[model samples]
Target chain A: MVILFPSKPSILACGAVAGPVERKSVFYSFFDSVIEDERWGQKTNEQGHSQMIQEACDILMKKAEINNLDVDFFLSGDLVNQMTPTNFAARELAISFIGLFSACATSISSVIIASLLTELGASELAIAGASSQHNAIERQFRYPIDYGAQKPATSQWTVTAAGYALVGKHNPEYPSIIAGTVGKVVDYGEVSPFHMGGAMAPAAYDTITSHLKKRHQKITDYDLIMTGDLGKIGLKILKAMFAQSGAKQEELDVLRDAGAEFYGDDKAFQAGASGAGCSASVFFSYIEQQLKIGRYKKVLLVATGALLSPMSFQQGETIPCTAHAIEITME
Target chain B: MDPQEYQQLEQQMTPPTPYLKNVLKAFFVGGIICTIGQAITYLYVIFFNFTEQTAGNATVATMVFIAMILTGLGLYRKLGQFAGAGSAVPVTGFGNAVISAAIEGRTEGFVLGVGSNMFKLAGSVILFGVASAFFVALIKLILVSVGVLEW
Candidate 1:
């Protein structure tokens, strides 16, 4: 469903923190901080995941010049089991917490909810975003990190990062969220857990197309439409689907994927970076910075997620995917 | 599009697995591992009072011990990635699998975690190995009774 925000909730500040490996990311400089240790000095990967989220939220609050007491709600999620990392973070932040799970799409989904709260005049300031830890998430969803299982080229590397945006009353000087689309679960019968992008591409296409049709806007209306983590092959599949639908070449040029281009053609990353933090970090830091500086006047941030658990995949169930999109425009 | 049509399209779009390259890697890596085992066997025969038959057990144990060290040091996984089935098909791979599972389950604690999960990946190998060994021994016994084979 497309939800129009007449109040135009503004992203007052954004904070993105990533792990040591993320220094190689193309948008590394845009991140607020890159922790040298993946575990952030924590005893376990999950604790480290929580630490990263806390650090990101701290940075966001610092940037916004607000304390935890000033914030009304904390909306967040992660790919870990029960989103325990985010839940732990919320406990530390001492904010009214609403834990969400749209898989990787939690980044945009959380923001959409924050915007709704802002529009309803129920929230003066809210922290919204998502996070993912490579070791923690990989161990949960795939194999143990030390397992020597050879992954296919379609596989994506989960990033250890957290991105949070402080959402508040509209300010013309900031990038304001004007609308959002809460995606329906779309399944194209994709079964391979290794090829997440292929499974999520169809859902992304569905959400974007529906958003455009319902909003009565053309593809060219936005400066960019970036999907969350449809890796190299998934982006190609999405483009192919669009091309077959008779989309013009120039119109398709605006399409981009945070996952496909994250590592800048590094073969070691295979299809590219993924995880809940993949889009969160990119959107809250790089994308938000671009909008604030007028580099991009309007853009659609579509975070797609493959909604399959380890049990579901093991039971021979196809991946059901979803994409949540928020349209950000600078005055 | 329908699921079948989309699946077909997805198949067309997805790249084919590089079988030739992977097979070549697997072959060389597997060969090197076997070469190392042979060297270890020779060392056992020369330095100790072990016969060739006795050295086989020592060599297997030594290989598994080395693999356990590599697994603890977090180096075997990288080798496994590079060598594919080469690292996995060997006895070293079995050791690595067991140790990795043990390490991964450490977060949950010792008895329930490490003890229960230590054999998660390698338990099948042991079960099938013993079962097949028993069946083969049974077949030989049957043939010997019929005077078709000698024990």
Candidate 2:
């Protein structure tokens, strides 16, 4: 079921921070802070993940003209195991914290939970954010930084970035979060590690169809229906799934994957960017820009995540996945 | 879906991997690595007065040591990216795999980090190697007893 916000919370401010690599991407203009140092001047890549979160949160607070004490809660997550980086960052920030894990779909997941909290009168102001580092994720999930192992063409490079959105009472100047749809874990018993797009496409399709059905809306109702980190292959699979379900070609045209959008024509990114930061960076930056400029009135940001562990993949278990969609409309 | 049905869906949904290109890269890189090993063996034989057989063993050891150093310096990942399976299927690749895990666990401190995690990736390779060797030796023993083979 789609959770409709009666008190529609406005995204007053957002902060998008990325590593030096993103500066090479087209979305460079959308970021508020781009640290050239991959380590963020930290001793390790794991430490850098926490530093990015803290910086992103600080930037969001500064943009919203609010202090740490003024915020009611901080909802954040990262791709790191146990989400220790987010936990450490919260320790430094000392705000009421809720650590979430939806793999790459975390940005929208956190936003949905935060917005729900605010709409239900549980929080006055809540911040939702996520961060991921290329090196840190590679080391933890696959091989170490030194393995020098070859990556398949379908392997998505993790985007080293963090994104934050501040949700509170509706404001005329900001885009309002009108609704959110929580996703179910859909696993078609896909076990391929390199083919994340295929593994996650089913869940994206499931969530998108459910959200549209619940709201009695057609695909044409939204200007853009974006999925988080489905990459190139995943997008094709999602479209095919929709087509088989009798969705028109024109209707499927609005579907765009955030990972594909950010790394367009960048051969170095193989498939695309995959991580919690993928949606966080793209939404808080590119999508937010289009909304602010009135280019798109209604947008469905569906963040997808492949809930797989290296141990599980090695143990012959299929990858389970989930996708969460948030409806943003500018009045 | 059942495993068989899911497998069919995966086959239909997944795109075809460029196997030819990967094979070419691996072949080229693997050849280069073997050529380097040969060169090291000759050097040991010619300059150190060692026999070819002993030099060959030393060459393997040297390559593994160098691979470990490259892993620590974070240069092996780049090689792996370019060479694909070529960098991974060799003895040196095994060294890189073990050292990489050890280094990754370094931040958590010695016992829990480096010591425990050093074999995360390479431990299986070692297990398989020993198991296969045992099987091969058992076969050799059976052949000798049956008078079908001579040592």
Instruction: Find the candidate with the highest DockQ and give its number.
Output: 1
For candidate 2, give the docking quality class from DockQ.
medium
Q: Which stretches of candidate 2 lie over 4 Å from their true place?
A: B1-13
TM-score, chain B, predicted structure 1 = 0.93
State what share of the real interface contacts each candidate retains. Answer: 0.65, 0.70
C-alpha lDDT score of every prediction, in listed order: 0.94, 0.88
Q: What DockQ does candidate 2 score?
A: 0.57
TM-score of each: 0.97, 0.95
Cα lDDT for residue B134, candidate 1: 100
Candidate 1 lDDT at A153 equals 90
Please provide, for model 2 over A129-178, each residue's C-alpha lDDT reduced to its tens digit, 9 standing for 90 to 100: 78899889988788777877777767788899999999898887889999
Q: List candidate 1 stretches off by more than 4 Å.
A: B134-151
Tens-place lDDT per residue, model 1, A1-331, is 9999999999999999999989889989999999999999998889999999999999998988889999999999999888999999999999999999999999999999999999999999999999999999988898778878778899999998889999999999999999999999999999999999999999999999999999999889999999999998899889888887889998889899999988888988989999999999999999999999999999999999999999999899999999999999999
